[model samples]
Structures are given as C-alpha cells and as structure tokens.
Target: MRYLFAEYVFDTDRRELHRGADVVSVAPQVFDLIDYLIRNRERVVSKDDLIKTIWNGRSVSDAALTTRLNAARVAIGDSGDEQRFIKTLQRKGFRFVGAVREAKEPAEAIVADDQVEVQKVDLALPDRPSIAVLPFENMSGEPEQEYFAEGMVEEIITALSRFKSLFVIARHSTFTFKGKAVDIKEIGRRLGVRYVLEGSVRKASGKVRIAGQLIDAVTGAHLWAERFERDLADVFALQDEVAVAVVSAIQPKMIQTEIEVATRRRPENLTAYDLFLRSMQQYYLTTRESLAEAIRLAHCALDLDPRFGSAAALAGDCHASNVALGYTNDPQFDRKEAVRLARLALRIGDDDPDILSRVAVILAGMVGDSEAEIELADRAVALNPNSWRTWNNRGWVYTMAGLPEEAILSFERAIRMSPVDPLLHMTFLGIAHALIALRRFDEAIVALKRALRHNPSFLPACRGLASAFAHLGRDVEARAAAARVLEIDPSFTISAHIARSPKSPKLFIEGLRKAGLPE
Candidate 1:
C-alpha cells in the first residue's frame, strides 16, 4: 500500500519514502514511525502506542520519542515550526494531518527502478504564493567569487522566507540544481513553485552588480526584472540591499497573481493554504463583516489541516482584534480563546517570524502581558531581523511597555524594510501611539492621520487620531474622530479599550474622554 500527500509518497510495503522521482533517505525507526502514523491517521496515536508498536513495549525515554518524531518530520521535508504533516495535540499524542490519498497497490510497483517502470507522480502546485530563487551565477571570472554568488543567493532566500505570505523553497533544496543547465518549466515541475527568481552576480574591481528576473514559471512569462549595482567594499550590505529590492519588487506581483488565482478558482477547489490567503485579504479590509468572514475562513483552513500553525495564528489575531476594537461583548471568552490559540501557535512555530509576530501582537493587544509579549517580539526580531512584521510587532510591544523612543525607532525600521506593506497603517498607528505617550501631540496627530489615510476603517488609528486631536485642542476634529470610532464600533467604551491596552498613558485616556467617548 502507498499513501501520498503533497509532494511525497510513503511506500509502506517497500519501507521507503519518495519525493517526486527522488527517494528520501529515512532512518529505520523513522520509517516505522511514519508508517504507524499514516496507518493510524484517523486517530491520534498515544506515546504508549508508539512504544508498544515501534519499540515492542521496550522502555523508551521521553527524549527518545521526541527525537524520533522530530526525525520523522525532518525526513519528509516538514518541520516542527510548520507542522505541515505531523501535529502534536498537547496532552493527546500525535496525528498526521495532511490530506492523504491511499492506493492498494504499492507505489514501487508503478514506478519501479527497472525497465518495467510505467507510472508517474502527479505534482500539484502549492496553493499559496510560492517561489524558488535559483542559485545566482558568478559572472566574475574568479573561482573564489563563486562563494560570494552562492552566499548572495542564500541571503536572498533567507530574506524572502521571512514573509509568511510566500512559500519559499529552502536553500538546500534549491541549491541542488546549482551548476546545472535546466529548463525553467522542468525546474517548476520538480520544485512545485509557481514562480522562479533567476539572477547572476558580477563582483570585481571593488564593484558589484546583481541582476534578477521574476518569472511566471507556469506560463514562462517574464513578470518583472531589475538590476542593482553597488560597491563590493561592503559585500554583505550589497547583498542585503539587493535582497530587499528583489523582495520589494516581487511582493506586489505575487499578490496580484494570488488575487487573479483566487478570483478564477471556485471556492470548493481551494486548498488550506488558498483559504488562508483569502482569509488574509479579508482580514486586511478591517471591516466588521470582513473580519468575521476572515475568522471563518481561517477556521476553515484549520479544519482542513489542523497542524497549520499560520492559520491558527491568524484566527487568534482576528479574535484579539475583535476585543481591541470593541467588536465583541464577550471580551473574556474572546481573550481566553485568543490566548489558547496563540499558545498553540507558539508551541508549533517558535522559529517562524510570522507566527511569533502574530502571537505577540494578539497577546499584547488583548491580554497586555508586557513582559511575555516583549520577549516573544524580541525573539521574533532575533530570528529574522529582515522581517518587517517582526519589527512592527516589536514596536507595538515597546509601545505597550511605555518605551516610546524605542517604539518609534522600531516602527521606523519596519517601514523602511517594507515601505509598501499593506499593513503599513498598523506601523503608523503604533508610531502615533508612541508619540502620544511622549506628549508629542502634533507629531502624533500627523502619524494618526497617515494611518487613517491608508486604512480608513482601522479603529485603533481612529482612536489614536481622536486622542491626538483632543490633546492638541482641536475639539471639532477630535469629536469627529471619536464619532468615527463609534460609527465603526457602536459599543466602544473607554474602560474596555483601556483594559485591552493596559499600559496606555493616563493622559491618553483623558484625551479620549475629552473627545466625548463613553467612560
């Protein structure tokens, strides 16, 4: 029998794992563990069951079991951070949560190594925005520059990976095709990415040039292209600049492609990742109905694949946003559920910048756990300093901790990293809040207005605008901003808002009160 999911096939009878045409090496114990999980995928397998079956009731340490489970995950090109296949159910054991299809005949029989081989594996393109950055070519004649070119590609890959919206191919997997003449179509087929970034780096005479082109791998379309030249004196800085430019150039292209794909595809045909993407679009609208729908779609994705940490994090974020904006009357229940989901996300995605930022933002926004939120935000930045979301969330953490100067700097960094980000309003809103705490009413008003310009319906920005105007003695505009908040969220109350933002300044609260908000 064989079980297939995503790009992998598990041949139980052959006792092997295969990714496309390539066989993946796995330890004997890992193979056994995977086989057991797939066979028992309908239910969670307890630790005792694992020991009883895999170890034949032998005494196994907890550490040994965890190691085997992690090994099994790594063997299948999955990770504890993503949990794309195996999922831990806290107290309950583990389950294989991928969408699996099984066949009675062994996969080896259909794709035999001998001349009798007749079958092929069908590769499905990943549902989300996916890209593979091919190894950059060394145009410089020196052989030593080869290392520099490879390092450039690695840096770009790392930077692209910081955006959770993108499904970036790992450096090791992509480097496999290095130094080889390959067709982009074949590369896309093998890698299962919709887009490919191919580039060449030339470095010599204290100068460097990096040229990149973004290709629509499916249709062989040249979507976008750019070139960057810089001094080689600071190679690392040049690499960083090039990576940022490449990412900034391609982000909107990918998002436009995603919008077209989502519009054309029927809802029934959507995958978990597709649903997650759609949910994100809805979440960005920042309207009551849209947020509710976003939460529903996020849950739908979670239902399809319970191990999807990103989906869980997004769902938790929506719940927290509801409380922060006074959209929920049951703040206590919402906060509890948000915290629970955030905790699960942290457990599964400790190293994912997006997950860490989402968890941090939701916790700090709704629960106001200053120390814990700050730690998570700092960890996120440490993990991926190039990620705009990490810096943006860190800014909020600092704001909630009353460190206005640090908050302002962090928000500025976030904007510089991803100036055209859709969530730029959130960064602006954070800056306004920080400036308000610093008693810079004029600057705070400008920042709040900027946020409102980007996202008119964002209530936090409205709240900040009202407070800033009140502090600046602009009573008419302050009252108008306060009215906008009530129009968006009729249940708006100063007490509830203050509870969500526990570290907000007393003066900021007084300004809101002066703007005629209900106490």
Candidate 2:
C-alpha cells in the first residue's frame, strides 16, 4: 500500500518515500519508525511497542529513539516544533496526526516523479499579522560590518516575534533575498507575509547608522520608517533601540489598519509558537471551554518541545486558572499538575522574565501566599518592567501577600502598560480583589463590572459582584449576581471558594452567605 500526505508519497512495498519529485532519504530504523507510526495512526504507539516491533525487543536509549523520531520527521518535511505529521502526547505515546489517503497501487503507476510538483509549504499566510525582515543592506563597504547589519535585522525579528500577535518568517527564509534586488510585493507574496521590513546598516568613523522602513506589501506604501545612529561602542544598544522602536510603532499601526491579514488558517499545521499563541488567545477568552482548549493546545506545544518553558508555564497557568475560576472538579489533581508544570518551567527558563512571572503567578494561586513567590514576581518585574504580564503577576503576588494597596498599584501599572490587552479582564479582576480587601465596595464593584464587560461569563467577576452588592445592601442585585455565579460555575460554594482564597476578607465571606450562596 502507498500512503499519501502533505505532498509526500510513502510506498510501503517499495520501502520508499517521495515528496513530489524528491525521494526523501531515511535511515532503516527511522523508516521503520515512520511506517509503524503511520500504521498505528489510529492509536498512540508506545515506546515499548516501537522497540518491540522495530528493534525486535532490543534495548534503545531514550535519546536514540528521539533522534530517530526527529530524523523521520525531517525526512517528511515535518518537525518536532510543528509536529504536523507525528504528534507526541505527554506520558502517553506518539501518534501520526497527519491526514493520509491510501493507494492500493504504487504511486509511480499513476504519475512519474518528474511530473509531480509539491505546493510551496508556506504558500498561505497565518491567521494573524505576518511580516518578514529582509537582511539589512550592509552599506559600510567593509566585510566585517556584514555581521552587524545582519544582526540588526535578526534583533528586530526576535523582538517582533515576542509579541505573539505577529507571524514572523524565519531568518532563513528572509535571508534568501539578501543581496537580490527584490520588490517588496514580491518578497511579501513569496514569504506569505502582509508586511515587509527592509533596512540598511552603515558603519563608519566609529559610528553606526541603522535605518528601517515597514511597508504594506499589498499597496507598496511605507507604514512607518525610522533611522538611528549611535557610537560603535553602542551597537548592541542601537540594535535594541531599533527593535523597540519598530515593535512599538508597528503594532499600533497594524491595529489601526485592522489589516485583514490571513489567507489560510490551518490549525493542525501550527508550530509550537503558533500553538502557544493560540493557547494564550483561548486563555484570554476567559471561558470554561476556552480554558480547556487552551490547556489542550499548550500540552501539544509542550509535547513538541518539552524544554519549551513558555508552553509548560502556559499549561500550568491554565490549570491554575481553571481552579481560580471554579472550572475544576478535581482541585487536588489540578493543583498538583499546576505546581509541577510551574517548577518544570522554572527549571527550564529561570532567567526568562516571562517564564518567571508565569511561574510566580501559578505558585501563588495554586500554592497560596509565599515569600518566595513575591521575590520571584518582583525579580520578573525588575527584569522586564515593560511587560504588562510581569506587572500583573507582581500585583497577584502582593494580593496574595496581604498587601492590597500595593497590589492595586501594581495592577494599575499593568493596565497602563497594556491598555488594550486581551487579558485586561484578569487585571481588572485583580484590582477588584484588592479593592474588596480594602473594604472599598463601590470601587470593587466598578472594577468587577469592567472585568465582566470583557468576559461576561467570568465566574469570579460574578462572585465578586455578589459580595460587593451584598455589602452595599443591594439585596436584589446581590441575589442576581449570586445566581449568575452559580450559572457560570455550578460547583461554586461559599466554603470551597473561601478555602481556595484563604485571604478573602471576612465581610466578603459574610456577603456570600447573605447573597444565598451555598455554604
């Protein structure tokens, strides 16, 4: 039988695989592994199964198996990061996830290899903003300056990629047009990007100049342009300056333009980073289904790259958030998983501010208030004060530490840092919590209302509204809010909620009782 998938034809009888006209070379073991995976595609294939079948029960180290699997992926235009063909399930096993069609006869019988052609892998744009940064022109006329010019473009690409909202073509793709006089439109179309960033770097007389312009490839209109010059000693600083300027300038313009960017949305073909971004978007939706989907996608990303601290942290956050929002039936299991994943993320990315903040938040929420958590959050914010997530996590640490005033201030800073963040609801909820702790019932209600505006079905906001209304002697509204909470989270009970939030104000608990919530 011949199996066909993603422009690749695998002829089992011939023991060969062909991608369009190209025959993909695979080691004997790797080929067997692929064959096993494809045959067992209906179910996950365990390591033992592979070792028993492919190796005839011979002992194989974990690393050896991983290398073989990676080789198999590469031979088929798949990758560990994308896992488009083979998927790894944590603690379960591996499975072939690609869509495949079967051919009873050999593929060579239908068409010759020379007549076959594969569609470009990146022919379609992603469902978000996408851009490509071409290599900066090295105008210095010195070969030594080439690295610096290339480095500047790389720096900008890295910074822009961190935004998660933007789809950045890899350096390998954009560098192909390095010395070529390619039109911006051609570059965009070839790269499947809506925007193209072109720049020039010149170094002379102990100084360096870097100029960059962002252009809408569709219309060939320059969206934004800036130039910076600095001492040679400050080249790294200049790179950072240019990156920050481009990031700050481009995002707002993309938002204002409301660029209808995507041409194709292939959820199954998402890379690890793409899956992470999708998980984050689901997380920001703040719904029970969304949170569950977020965890699933994060797990897939984690499986693709076990060392991906961001994916582990995101999965941990989802587990913690489920408990926080009363979306969990098994709190103990969720709590354990949340703490374990947080620590894993910490071990992998202790120095990353985003990971530190994420771990800190998970620890604080799942493990309760701790001095270590406060320090972690503070360090994260100190490392990246510009990140609203770091500031938001700092706020959470303080809230759990019983510093309501300080927590409120930190939350306010987070809001200012990202005024239009999709995660705004969580920040607003943090403010509400701090205000409630301070006995500022009216202000707390306003903050809770704002949170509900972002996520109408947010159980925590509904619960907060119940307490705030009860405190204000608005019995009807209090009961209504309490009902909403139960509607959103059927498992919500006063005692369970109080146990989860040990730091809840006594009045808040009393109000829950007054609002007729289950004891």
Candidate 3:
C-alpha cells in the first residue's frame, strides 16, 4: 500500500518513501512509522493506544521514542518548530494532518486475488478446545422482554469472552442466529467456531426459568446442559448464576462447577438479585452512564441482601471500570471503594473463581497486592484451567514481579486459547520483553513483529523492535522504530519504562542503551 500525502509518497509494501522524482531513503522502521501515521490520519492517536498497537505492551523508554520522532521529522522536512505535517499532542499522541491518497489497489483485494488458488487450503484444527455462545430464545410472550433474554445471552457472551482460552463469536455476529432454527454444525461453520451454546428463557406466573445446553457443533455432540428456576424478582441473578454454571459445565476439566452446584444454594427470594444481575449486564458494556446505573442496581440488590458477594464484587468492578477508563474524576476515591468492596466480596465467598478473579485483578492493578493477587490468580486458574482471565492475571503478576519468562509462558498459553483476542497481542509483547531481558535481540524482534501483526498501533512492540535493531548495529532501522514510538508518544522515555519496570533497572537500562537508546 502506498499513501500519497502532499508531495511525499510512502510505499508501505516496499518500505520506501518518495518525494516527487527523488527517492527519499528512510529506514524501514521510520517507513513503518510514517506508514502507520498516514494510514490512521483520521484521528488523534493516544500514547497508551499507540503502545498497545506498536509495542504490544512491551516496556520501552520515552527517550527512545523521542529520538526516532526527531529523525522522522528530519526525513520529512518537518520539524518540532514547523509542525506542518505531523502534529504532536501533549498528553495524547500524534496526528498526521497531510491529505493521503492510496497509490495502489487495496492490500486486502490484492492478497485475496493472489491467494485465490490457496484459498481452499485446509489446515489442522487447533489442539485447544473452543466454544461459542448462541443467543438464548425468549420464552416470554412479550416482545419487550426480548432485551431481557438478549441481555442474558449477552452476559454469557461477555463472561465467556473474558476466557481467552475460549474461542467465542462476537455478540453482534452470534446474536444474528436468534429466532432462527439452524443446525448447530451450520452455525459453527459460519462462525468458524467449534462449540455452540443454545438455550431458552421462559417467564410465567411471576417465576423465571432458563435452560441451556452446550454442543460440540462439529461432532454434533451435546457436551453439557442445565436448567434453572427462580422467582421473577431474582431473574437477573439467576441469569448470572446460570451463565457461570454453563461456562463450568462446558469445560470438562472444571470440577468446581459440580461443587458449586452441590453446595451453594440460591437465595429464597430472587427479585433483588435478578435486578442486580441484569444491572451487571449493563455495567459490563463499559459506558459511563451504564456503570452508574449498574452501581445503582447493584446497591439495590445489596439493600435486599447485604451479604450478596457476587453483587458486591460486581459493584466494585463498576467503580474500578469507572476509574480505569477515566470516567471518574477522582480515581483515588474510586480505587479505594473498589478495593474495599472487592475485599468484602472475597471475605464473603472468596472460593468462587469469578469472585476471586475479580478481586485478584483489583488487588494487583489498583492496590499492588502482588502476593495476594498471585495467590488468588493461582486459585482461580486451579478452579478453572480453561479460564483466559486466570492466565492473563497470572501473566500480569509475573510481568510485575519481573519474571518475564513465566509471564511469556502464561501469555503464550492465553494466546493459544484465544488466538484472535486483541489482548493476546500483549502476550507477544511480553515474550519480546522476556527475550530482550535474556539478551536475545533477534528473538525479541521476531516476537515484536508478530505482535505488530495483531495490532499495528502497539508502541511497545515498536520500541522493542527498535532496541533490537539498535543493539544489532542497525542504527537507521532502530532510529526509525524509535521515531515511530515518539510520533505516538513524544514523552515516551526508555529511561522511564526501565525505571517503572519491575525488573532490575540497571540491567534493563544496560540492554536498552546497548540497543542504541540515547541516555
């Protein structure tokens, strides 16, 4: 793909930049950075977003990024003072203001045409287990309750989506099967998924009922099934409970599901719990107003039963989301409340993987409780080995504890479980970081490239790639990579990433400096 902007033409496929008749020789890394900027010229990219995209969440410094950006500007006849084409945002990132035009057919179309003969290539199925959540049928006579039933299916989808080890179809695409009587095999083929979840919901006489079954769509085998009944007042709670149960039942190795079903009994009155569960569905959507509404509904459930650990944990999740997403003005206050509620939930019923996993995330991210977080994450994984979140959390703990190799393994497991997951890109970044720590520059570059394939905007991957190039004496490519990072985050300093890193600062800095980062 070639992006024509002003008088300059950037050939992404060839990794070349052209100015009219002159071939402007730019380093491959610089070419990549310019290509990304031109491609994403529509919006102001943020630092975190860039890091996530370019680096795959690997650790890099602000100085490295700045040095590269300066070099890129020099290449383009643009300067920090002139600010003609690429404009840098203070806390945000960068924006390419030049008008861009494609110089060739779309890359997708070309690739499709070239690979048309190989399109029918059949590959072996992955060794990992996979499943999909089908839309639940609405047994309620009222069409207004469609949202309620849809909400139930959506909740299951979200919960399952968190399990990176599971291949779940997106809710938007999966819900298309609603109100249709389709073959499970057909659904699997259409979605490129292995398992399908089918269920029905019926509300009658102030009582709610739900039945769900998991099917191995390819083999046409019914892997798991369950039915639940609850008062209409607690319908929401029942839905959440059922979702958790269904997740457990589908995973052959999760024995805790049986224990939970055998020992934990539902509350006598389900009304408030139902409302809370429904509200949680809203909360998971991750909108500001929705989070507030979720909190309100969760509080209502607590009013009915202050001892409801699930509801309280969810409430804490709401606050944490609010704070994490920058929705709340006072993160400190929200963080404190989130920790308090999460702790309360753990105290009430810490054994539940759902509750423990939630608490573990809060403790690790918000409270910095490494020991407790690792323990909780370990327990969560022990309870549900197929859980993506469990592995993600474990990887997170390892990263923070400076155990990059362990973190890389955990992330690799997570990626194997959910190859298409956006977050799995971070695992690739983790691998690169570990490789870099072990002084394997070539391996780090390879891993970073893999991560960039998943998310082109990942800045950490870009930085790591630059470090590798620098260490290998590929100054031009290293500078270009560093420039791309700077274009995404001007304040990005290699020193800072090393300082904040959980690993040994001296060793981290030594490696980065050797990789060509300016002091």
TM-score of each: 0.80, 0.58, 0.40
> Each model's C-alpha lDDT?
0.81, 0.78, 0.65
Candidate 1 structure lDDT: 0.81
Error (Å) of candidate 1 at residue 265 is 2.1
219 Cα displacement, candidate 3 (Å): 22
Q: In candidate 1, which residue pairs get closer than 3 Å at backbone N, Cα or C atoms, i.e. clash?
A: none
Q: CA shift at 161, candidate 2, in angstroms?
A: 9.2
Worst 10 residues of 1 by lDDT: 114-123
Using lDDT, rank the candidates from best to worst: 1, 2, 3
What is candidate 2's lDDT per residue for 271-309, written digit by digit as tens?
A: 776677777777777677988998998999888878677
Best by lDDT: 1
Model 2 regions more than 4 Å off:
1-264, 267-270, 499-505
C-alpha positional error of residue 10 in candidate 2 after TM-score superposition, expressed in Å = 35
